[model samples]
Target: MQRSKLVSQILEKKNYLCVGLDTDTEKLPAHLKNKPDGIFEFNKRIIDATLEHCVSYKINTAFYESMGTKGWEIMQETFNYIPDSHFKIADAKRGDIGNTSHQYAIAFYETLKADAVTVAPYMGEDSIKPFLSYKDKWAIVLGLTSNAGSKDFQQLILSDTGKPLYETVLETVAKWGNIDNTMFVTGATKADFFEDIRSVVPEHFLLVPGVGAQGGSLSEVSKKGANKDIGLLINASRAIIYASGGEDFDLAASEAAKEICNEMKGYIV
Candidate 1:
């Protein structure tokens, strides 16, 4: 999606929520658990329920990949099911040697038809460049993640720059691709760092996960992370989709999303 289009959606919707379809077999409602297409059916209902309340959907590849061949089909089907009006993200977190990365890019952007794919930048620019080669596609490189493990490397101080490693990453990675083709994945749990992150890459978009179930503060993230375009995509997975486990699951999910969307209205403008 073009940056203008994404920004327009945010402005029009007055929210930046990105519903994550991290659909797990263990979490499937009892009625759908034994069905052949249980996972996809659950996903369809979730999408149908929450489509009006979000601007994007993130399909975490791990859940589907764990299911083997059948999972890939479901992932593709889910991607195809999302309306073109909303941005589609493949939260795969893939990066490697240039050629291998190129194939991964093709797998998501061309085959699966995703608007963006999350990537690991620890390997350097070559690992990310392949994803940027596609028009209107995004390489959402990891900056400062939300997990407890992020402190292991991302927060380490650099000897020469007198800055955290992720700060250097934000400075350096921002140069590889212009704002149009690049974005950063800064976990919403790391809300305190948003002001500084904005200082490094003020014009680029940010794919912010770790809200809701992960307990990240949406108000703080929105207050500091938003640029003139409101460059943020706040993701919520289990908190919304699994809002209920019974037959009312779809309505419950819709209500959960509506609550978040309403909360977001107070932050955007």
Candidate 2:
């Protein structure tokens, strides 16, 4: 999807929620465990339940890939199942040498047909360039991530630039790709850094995780990170998908999503 259509969806729905489908077969409801296609069944219900409240769906590929061929098949099925109106993301933090990254790009963008894929920028521009070559697709580069390990590198102050490494990544990458086909992953846990980040790439979209289950603040993210276009796709996974483990799981999930969407309504405007 183009940036215009993505921004349009956010405005039209009064939401910028991205529901993460990190569905684990082991954690599925008791009734679904014995079903023939339980993974897809669970995802279908969650998607149906929350579609009205979200603009994007992020599938963490590891959960599906662990199940082997069956998992891969269902992953594609789930991707194909999402409505064209919603942005589809493969939350696969993949980055490698130039040739390998090209194949990885083809796998997610061409074969699986995801609108965006999360990529680590550790390998620098060569690792990310192939993904950006595709039209209307996005390379969501890892920037200021939320995990504890981020402190090791991303937060370290650079002597030359007099800024943290993550800020340099954002500023340097802005020159590599425009807002239309490039975005950065700015974790909600790093909400305090949003002001500095905005000064670097004011127009780029940010795929923010760490809310809900991760205890990141929604209000803070909005106050500090949101651009004039509301350039943030805040994600909620376990808190919504696993809202309840009973037959009413879908209803609970819907309620969780609606609650977040309602909260987002105030921020979008």
Candidate 3:
């Protein structure tokens, strides 16, 4: 999906909510725990229930990968079930040497056909350049993440530039790919820094993942992070996906998604 189309969807739906599909069998309702395709079944219902309220769906590849081959099959099935109008994301956090990155790019871009994939930029330009080569696909680079350990590296001041590691990353990588194909992951927990991060890369979109279960404030994030295009994809996973542990899980998920979407609508331009 082109960036314009994504923007349009957000505006048309009055929401920029991205539902995270971090499906885990252990967390599945007891009724589905013994089902043959529990993961896919859970995802299908979540998609069906919340598709109208959300503009995107993010599938954390690790959850599926841990289940091995069967997990992969279900992941593909879940991917196929999502409507084409909604953006599909593979939260793979893949980054490696150029050659390996090329295969990773093909896996998510060609094989799984995800609209975007989260990428770790620690490997430098070569690790990310391959993913940018594809058309209408995005590389969502890790930036000021909400994790407690982000301060270890991303917050360190550069020796010469006097800017934080993430600031330098935003400046350097923005040159390699334009707004349409490149985006940064700025955790909603870092709401205060949104203004600072936006100062460096004001126009590019941000995939924010620290809301709901992580306690990231939506109002603060939107107030400081939004741009002329309202370039923010706020993701909520556990809070929405596991909103209930009973048979009404899908209904609960939909309700939770609607609550966030309604909140997001107020921030929409």
Candidate 4:
């Protein structure tokens, strides 16, 4: 999807929620566990139920990859079910050298047909540049992630730069691709630092996780991170998708998503 079109969708919907499809087979409803295509069936319902409340869908590849070939097939089927009007993201977090990275890009962008794929920037420019080369597609590099382990390296203060490594990352990576094709995975748990991060890459979009189940504040992230175009994709996974374990799971998910959308409407510019 083009950057302009994504922005248009956000404005048109009055929200920027991105539902995370981190479906776990073991955690699926009891009835679905016995089905031949349980995972895909669960995903189809979640997508259908929440479609009206979100402008994007992010599929965490690990969940699908775990089931092996059948899982991969289910992942592709779920991707196909998502409407093109909303941005599709494959949360693969893949990063490697030039040739290897090119194949990863092809797997997500060409094979899976995702509009964006999360990437790790620890390997530096070459590992990330290939994804940026694709027009209208995005390379979502990890900046300040929400994981507890992020403090181990991402927040380290480098002697040479005298700044948290993540700040340098935000500044350096922003130069590799324009605001149109580049986005940073700035965790919602780091809302306090959004103002500082925004100073580094004000125009680039930020894929924010941790808002719901992780206890990150939506209003705080919006107040500090949003630009004139509302450059944020706040994702809620377990909190929405697993809102219920019974037959009403789809309705529960829809209600959870709608609640978030309502909060987002107040924050949208």
RMSD of every prediction: 0.7, 0.8, 0.7, 0.7
Is 1 or 4 the stronger prediction by lDDT?
Answer: 4
How badly does each model clash, as a count of residue pairs? 0, 0, 0, 0
Best by lDDT: 4
List where candidate 4 sits over 4 angstroms from the true fold: none
Error of 3 at 169 (Å): 0.7
Clashing pairs in 2: none
lDDT of 3 by residue, 64-169 (tens): 9899999999988888899899999999999999999999999998999999999998999999999999899999999899988989999999999999999999
Q: Give the Å error, residue 240, model 3.
A: 0.4
- lDDT by residue for model 4 (148-222), tens: 999999999999989999999999999989999999999999899998999999899999999988989998999
TM-scores of the candidates in the order shown? 0.99, 0.98, 0.99, 0.99
> What are the per-residue Cα lDDT tens digits for candidate 1 across 1-269?
99899999999999899999999999999999999999999999999999999999999999999999999999999999999999999999999999999999999999999999999998998998999999999999999998999999999999998899999988888888889988999998999899899999998899999988888998899899988899899999999999999878889999999999999999876
- For all candidates in order, the CA lDDT equals 0.93, 0.94, 0.94, 0.95
Point out the worst 10-residue segment of candidate 1 by lDDT.
169-178
lDDT of 4 at 5: 98
